[model samples]
Target chain A: MSLNFCFLGAGNLATHLSKSLKEKGFNIIQVYSKTNKSAKTLADVLNSDYTTSPAKITINADVYFVALKDAVFDEVLSKINLENKLVVHCSGSLPVSVLSAYSDKTGVFYPLQTFSKQRDVDFHKIPVFVEANSEEIQNKLIQIAEKISDSVTVLESAKRKYLHIAAVFACNFVNHFYTISAEILKTKDIPFEVLQPLILETALKVQEIEPEKAQTGPAVRFDENIISDHLNEIKDLKNYAELYNSISKSIFEHHQNLK
Target chain B: MSLNFCFLGAGNLATHLSKSLKEKGFNIIQVYSKTNKSAKTLADVLNSDYTTSPAKITINADVYFVALKDAVFDEVLSKINLENKLVVHCSGSLPVSVLSAYSDKTGVFYPLQTFSKQRDVDFHKIPVFVEANSEEIQNKLIQIAEKISDSVTVLESAKRKYLHIAAVFACNFVNHFYTISAEILKTKDIPFEVLQPLILETALKVQEIEPEKAQTGPAVRFDENIISDHLNEIKDLKNYAELYNSISKSIFEHHQNLK
Candidate 1:
């Protein structure tokens, strides 16, 4: 039997997820966004009804995916009447319990990858994390997720939150380091392209070895002179200097613990 | 005319470089290391003479690449004499002046990539930073580098030092974040493979867009609540807690500056 989906937010995640699902032969009954323009844009792509109000959400869908911003999740849940429909929120940090306020068939369907509207994501490679208040809903969500992705797993709320936090550190925080590196290179008229190979290899190394075992650089080797030199170079920038100090000290201490 | 090469150290960088240059038809005439075991191993692979003592370094080579550890670079350089033969140090932090101490024909041939003995680096893609005491040797070093890598540039010592520091942040410090994330996932029985795709994409994204613009996360969005929650979750590990706070604060402040 074909399942129907209603996306509550027509943002990055919503657009990607709905399109992937629709392409996989699922019916997208409706799309809702805080703004009508976004709702219409995404709904037009999926050939689904578009709305800016939660009250106008199609009550006929098998699943209602509330893919809104984290801050507005609670407020938006209050305005919906999911009742018996399986309502899932595609948020990493939020729990499935948030959907229980509006629907008995509450669940979570968080895709464990960063999504950019400008970039097309391969659903087969993305890990869709599913969790729910009941096994029936959990199984249904898992079935739907498995259709789109090769990696589908049921992660509980507790682990999911930590996973989300880790994602922030691994994806978001790591990108900031690249930004800092780019900023540093720009000062000397060096293009960031020079560092691209190094950055790619750094991530690639972990695939073949444990990250702790794969760790390299002056800090891992405890080369205090290079550390001091790097610190001295960035001393003019207060935050970067502090960031360098703290992360280097942490790496030094982590290696010490391993020893 | 094809240049003759002498590698002053049989370490990771030396091994990869010697192999690449030799494959490119540059004759590696001699390989030297403090330990005869490593020297013999690398020399045998390159079909070159091996020695433990720097005094035994062949004077026949056109260029001598000092690829020793930073702590041992000065001591090793003191024991070698090339006179008119060009000398270069494969170090990011050290200036060309270090090589000038032993020979007037001094230069820098720093390959800005992290190498592991077990993995083969594609020399064509590696960025080789070249510098020299004289334009003649500088152009010569660039010529040698260009033979191995498609991307070669002349970068002076001052800018090179900052580039190296930025590299540490981009490659080394960022790897530490992966280590931390791996550690966190291990505690919950989640395999690090779950985060591998995200890690690769995070690095790949910057190849197309600016890192600052590609940045996404709680800190980038200034989601204080999620940031606080993540901090609270990591508070038990003193160093990780501090690292989280320091980097998160730095990212928040950096984004604010751009606004």
Candidate 2:
């Protein structure tokens, strides 16, 4: 029989994960959220019941997946009575120990990709990191994770934190550069779409070459003339200039150390 | 009839553009570089004659493409006698006027995409930015550019400079984040490939949504606990810490302004 899942949140991550699980033949039995609209919205899509209160969460499901914000994990989990039912939280930074008080069969099921409600990601391509307190639970979680994703690994909490940090640099910080690029182009009345191909290629290049080997531009070459020219052009934008200087210095120093 | 071309500085940009033009049925008649090996390497691929000496560049070709380093533009252009032939430099930051001293039909044929010799990019999708001294030259360049690229724009030198700066932020600086991400993951003995999906998706997200709206992570949310935890974890790495704080503040300020 397919293991039934009761989701404890209906945010971007929960909405996507639950929908993906449902599509993969697992039963998303119930949805729970602090807000009625979000809970109902996702539940309606999954054809599952939903409740805005954590105390009202169904105990019939074999597995409970907590997808709450990092801050409310404690408060939300405290109210639920899982009766030692298997539980997992989909968080990159948070540890499995966070769920130890709530259930003995606790694990982590972190899908290492950015999730937006509007965006539909191919879960099969996403790297899902799973960890549990016991081998039985770990295997059980991995079995389910493998069904939805082709790349599933058992990553411990100690290393998982670093993975999350690495993701911040790769995704969040990289996207910040995209935002900065758009702002710079806006000043010249140029559309952000022009930078899209360059942006996509930059990401694509690293897949083939190591990021260190793939480094280009003034900073990597330490071309002071062009670097100074760019600095002067964006000097009015204090934050961007600072970033340009700092990141350029970092790239230069990184290469220097490499030598 | 196809226009004959002579390429100067057989570097990444020159090699890719020349090969792309050759594939599109344009005749590459000659290749010139400071190093004989570099010149002959590209020349052999195109089945064209090559010369290391700038003066030895063939004047038989209707178009002379200057893809030399920014610092060597004047030194090399002074040596090559293009006379009244159309001379176009493929540079992002350099102004079109830089070629005016060399020839009356000078123009800029800047492709707004990152190029590496090892990587084969789809030229048809790459946006090519063109600029020239006259409307006639501009039209001629645009026609040639259109044959190679579907998206061709006639942008002036002033606006093109900003576009180059934007590319730096979008490609060069963004690539630095990938390097940093790899370094962070190295500490935990985690493979860089784990972050590949996240990096690619981050770039992909901007294509479907505005980067400002697509932004995620602790920085955008001002999640103090997770931010502080991450800062403490990477505090030993002074430069990474500084970048984390700086970029986080920028993201915070940016979103704050939007409200």
TM-score of each: 0.96, 0.97
> In candidate 2, which residue ranges exceed 4 Å CA deviation?
none
lDDT of 1 by residue, B58-135 (tens): 878988888887888777777766788888898899888876668888888999998888788898999999999888
> Residue A36 of model 2: what lDDT?
93
Please list all clashing residue pairs in model 2, or write none if there are none: none
Recovery fraction of native interface contacts for candidate 1: 0.80
lDDT of 1: 0.86
lDDT of 1 by residue, A221-256 (tens): 888888898888888876788888878888889999
Per-model root-mean-square deviation over C-alphas: 1.6, 1.5
Report model 1's interface C-alpha RMSD after superposition on the true interface residues.
1.0
lDDT of 2 by residue, A39-157 (tens): 99999999999999878889899999998878998788888787769989988888899888888889999999998887999999999999999999999998999999999999999
How close to the true structure is residue B142 of candidate 2, measured as C-alpha lDDT? Answer: 94
